[model samples]
Target: MADLQVEVMGKDEGVMDDYIGKFTLSVTPGTKEVEIEGTVFKIVMGTFWIKIESTPSQDKHRLQFPYLFDGPIHYSRHYSPAVGLLTNFNDAWLYSTFIKGVPLFFRNNFQLWNRKGPASFAVRPGIQAGHRLLYARAAGNAFGIIEDTKGVVELLHTGAQDDVSGGGGPNAQRRVKPAVYTYIISAEDASFRFSETGAAFFVDFASKHALHSNCAEVVRYSGEFHPRPEGGWQNFGDFTPDDPVKWEFMIDNNSGTYAPDKMLLPEVKELFEFNFPGLVVRALDREDERLVESREACRAYALKWRGVRTDELQLHVREGEVTLCRRVSESGQQEMKRAKDNFT
Candidate 1:
């Protein structure tokens, strides 16, 4: 899990800004994935509380981070969640395939499992077939970045050539230049506030498992973020019609096998289960102030049902502060008691 914080303090001038910061990056054992947690501030705009995770696998890593806004995303007026998600996702993929996967270069000689037969990190790239040399070059071309490969092999071969020829000629031993990974984050506005930043990492491709296929293996996938989920894991944010916070607050209001009339009810169930252990709620049509009268009538026949305990239960409100005059026995309890009474 990788957690990072990019804070925007205040715009200075000419694509630069005064920024405050708190960044943390953590990786769990047995998994190459990184979990990230922190806050991001944009000058006088707003704040972002984000919990992002990069899960590395035997074949590929995945990232579908969560971003929460306390105030507003004025820039949010027009933006593609899919595009933003994919843009971030491309970084993870590039790391696993092109950057981290560079070790395959040395392994190609023996083709030992093609460097991909065994999953090294989470979501490992499939062992590329063909020559490692060709694969490296192709991967570059496929991603429309072959200059990277040339730089990679040139760096390695240059070092070897230098050792042999002792540096001489147009092919004179030039220092091997490795591929570098740089991250650039920026924010701009009409008022002329500009803040752009960058950081870089190096990649070594002297591995043996490298593939040699001129055809770059480019993979593309598409999926939607589920909201108000009917089946399972839901992602809630601005896009969701249901407010994530409110849904979390009222989840205990409904539950069971079938659908609940309130669209937010079902989704709330997920939020509740995620936060609390157990919740018991009574969904009475409080709009009918005569609820007590109806409960009383139901209690009158509680004995006829199946299980009846104390005839009825008192509503607990204000945490022992207020006690109401009317209440109804739990239906489940009434049914069980009634059944036992009949059996007796």
Candidate 2:
């Protein structure tokens, strides 16, 4: 087959990036299958690449593309640790050795990761280093970030971009600027930078997708996403007589449940645990508590068809110096009763 060439027009505008990827295929006379041999192609301005997908197809072996750096790598969208390195350009560096005979010679584009956290890997991930880290780490890539003496948060042999605020040192809140204007994710249509008022301004990720809405709420630029007025957020909703103090307690307490959903994505849990175990554990515990609370709360609104689904819960208790374990379950309105005890 002739060399494939793919011309990519960046969805953004007035920009073009090319690719030089590689792929393969082979067929025998009367059969419907073709043996395929694929390889890692390159990502450049306008070159074509190929990789043999299912050469021996149940149908004719007629699948071919001669103009793309990659084929069938569709969700080739996976990320790696090198992304963090790019985001944290704080005097940190990365290195790696090329695969034995590949000509690209340790090129700056490819992505790959093995243990030591996404460093200088072949381009299995993609071009943008930060995106790679965000994807890989969030997607639960096991060997994503490996901490060393300097803690570059690297992969293979490359280094990740250092944290912007030097990693929230000391009293953290005091050391770090309140208004973090940047966001972890990037889109051609959006750009984010921190503000001095402890508020963030940027494109709304969820809002931009489908029927979510187009309002770029002044949300907090943390790991999660939440809607707030443009400068910063100071408290949660208040339901008590003394609105101010009550609001403070709500923010300090239960806001961990629904408010922070924007930052804590499903993909970020493991990395969160690894980087900050205590906080991660606390988050997990909070989640579990919320789940239990929800289950009990549901009882108040349960339908007439709702029946008690009795179950055993092994409880570990300590009364003074004594330790006791017990098993418990739901019965009739007991679930609602338990929920009220917890919140009230």
Candidate 3:
């Protein structure tokens, strides 16, 4: 069992007082399943979901461990000073390496953890550098952060135009200016990166087809469709192939956020009308009633992976402890109980 205190801080060294809280939880050795909303068991699996909020500001921030846990999970609830809403969120995995209990190198890019080798770094629980040490740690690819003797956050390697902040000091937020963004995901492992705006090219793991998308209308570009020479996003809707096979707009929703039926599809239909003037484009989400077969096919394909389904939890602060609550099922609602409590 361990006792922990939590505090929320801003990039400018200002503490969010309202978000400060204390909680205690038991961590059994070799424990397997942890019943957060029910009875506790052994073997805890899946990602850790953490949400922090302030009462006065009313700003709520959520941090969810990545499905394929590699590095730090960063989520920004505040807007950047440069851009209002654009470039507001950044989701990327960073990696660092250690050998023989000494820091070797640190790289902020998409790289898997190097397991099974003579130089494999030690995997241990708790953080040592920060003011408030985090005792709870999980198995993952790389170390989160390491400070040099000089108390400086050192970056041995970084991608092109990679900006890292909050080095050997308190938590700092990275700054990114607003510009055209290019999202490239390999079809093989789904490893993705949001490249710098107007980046000429990128090279990643080998794949038959590379899924590419710019901050443009929802459509897949085929057969030598590149960004326009002029800055900003080029509307691919303006281009028409001489030998057209089929004209269709593809809505990709790997984020799992519901945007197809509400935002992307409607905007795509409008763009199609504006570009072709007379052509009418009807777009639908995969789960739409009209596309029952497609939805079933998608489900079948997903089932092939045998991915575990995680529950959606609601965050609540009750009596100074950070507890997770989940709504009761309809059958249990007759007793007037709304949720089940589980402390983290």
Candidate 4:
């Protein structure tokens, strides 16, 4: 469901500056005969094949299985610091074990999903079994600067002792601090410029659903902005008499099964507000209305080939042609059609 570009670079006259033609490749696992247009070339050993294997499962919310796909899922459940420190170790382990098979978190592959409801804003810790709270705290650094559970527990104890004789009324309950999420953007190269002064940056969207499509549409963003007093623009800039500019942008979800990434919202807002002055930005993850329906359609298309062995699906490419043929247990052969749904 995506297009890939293959660029050929050559060394000519000891300069290594020769530019060869570029060819496009389909995203699906298949083979296709391609022509090299230039000097005379010999075609020797022009055969290759690819196979996709997986244990079929009917769990719609299953984000990942190591035996099926070999990578960690993008989603994780997070707990508030106070609550996390107070949780019992046995209770956490039991909860993780029970929920790992229940499929609470949504699956994310190829693209991110922003569900259309209040659930998108809710955080449920230890809900994803594959990534439990203990694993995240010890391995993934989910608790921010608090590296380990011991540090969190120590902090909680210190706070409780301090609150016992603190200057609040005897009837007043001690308040537990909530976790805060901070956004940090870093550049590897120091010379790289994010934007030019006094210029409007345009956001663009390109769909991966259709092959042979090279067109990218400009994204229109709707938000407010206030001018900075010194020079450049900043979101919620510190300037008196702040007047907000309202702007809107368009989004084309050609890959119907996925939505815009929520983590990128801060970066997107920064890209626009920092580049364009007097722009006040209030950004949210835009969810598609038909996301569930589109996702189900794509999942159905992929699951149709369930129970079929990996070797059954075969691909062969020769002489400017590509063919995907399925082998049956009997003696017959059937040609499988290219995937139309934007699933894989």
> Which tens-of-lDDT digit does each residue in 1-344 have in candidate 2?
34223333322111112233333334223223222222343323233334444343332223432221211111111222232222221211111111111111212221111123222223212222222122332232322222221111112111222231222112212111111111211111112211111111111111111101111222221222211212212331212222112110001111211133423433233323333232222222224654334323322222211232221011122232121000011121354585689999
Q: TM-score: which candidate is best?
A: 2
TM accuracy, model 1:
0.15
How high is each candidate's TM-score? 0.15, 0.21, 0.18, 0.18
lDDT of residue 315 for candidate 3: 16
User: How many times do residue backbones clash in model 1?
Assistant: 56
Q: Which stretches of candidate 3 lie over 4 Å from their true place?
A: 1-264, 268-282, 285-288, 305-344
- Residues 1-344 of candidate 4: C-alpha lDDT, one tens digit per residue: 44655555453221113556555556555455654444336333222233433344555544454222212111122232322332211111100010122111212312332244221212211112112212233322222222222222222220232212112223223322111111111111111011111111000111111000111111111111211212212222222321122322111223221333455455555543433333344444435443333333322332342232222121112243211110110112111121233334
In terms of lDDT, the best-performing candidate is: 4
- The per-residue C-alpha lDDT of model 4 at residue 37 equals 44
Query: Candidate order by TM-score, highest to lowest?
Result: 2, 4, 3, 1
Alpha-carbon lDDT, every model: 0.22, 0.22, 0.23, 0.25
Candidate 3 per-residue lDDT, tens place, 1-344, comes to 23223323223211111222223333323323222221134233232334432222221211221122222222111112211111222222222122110011111122222233121222110011110110112132123332221111122111112222333222222211112223332222222223222221111111101213221122221111111111211222223321221222222222211122233445434533333333334445545553343333333332332241211011122243211101111222432342243321
lDDT of 4: 0.25
Model 2 / residue 150 / CA error / Å: 10
lDDT of 1 by residue, 26-110 (tens): 4333333322223443223433444444433433221221221111111111111221231221111111112221111111111
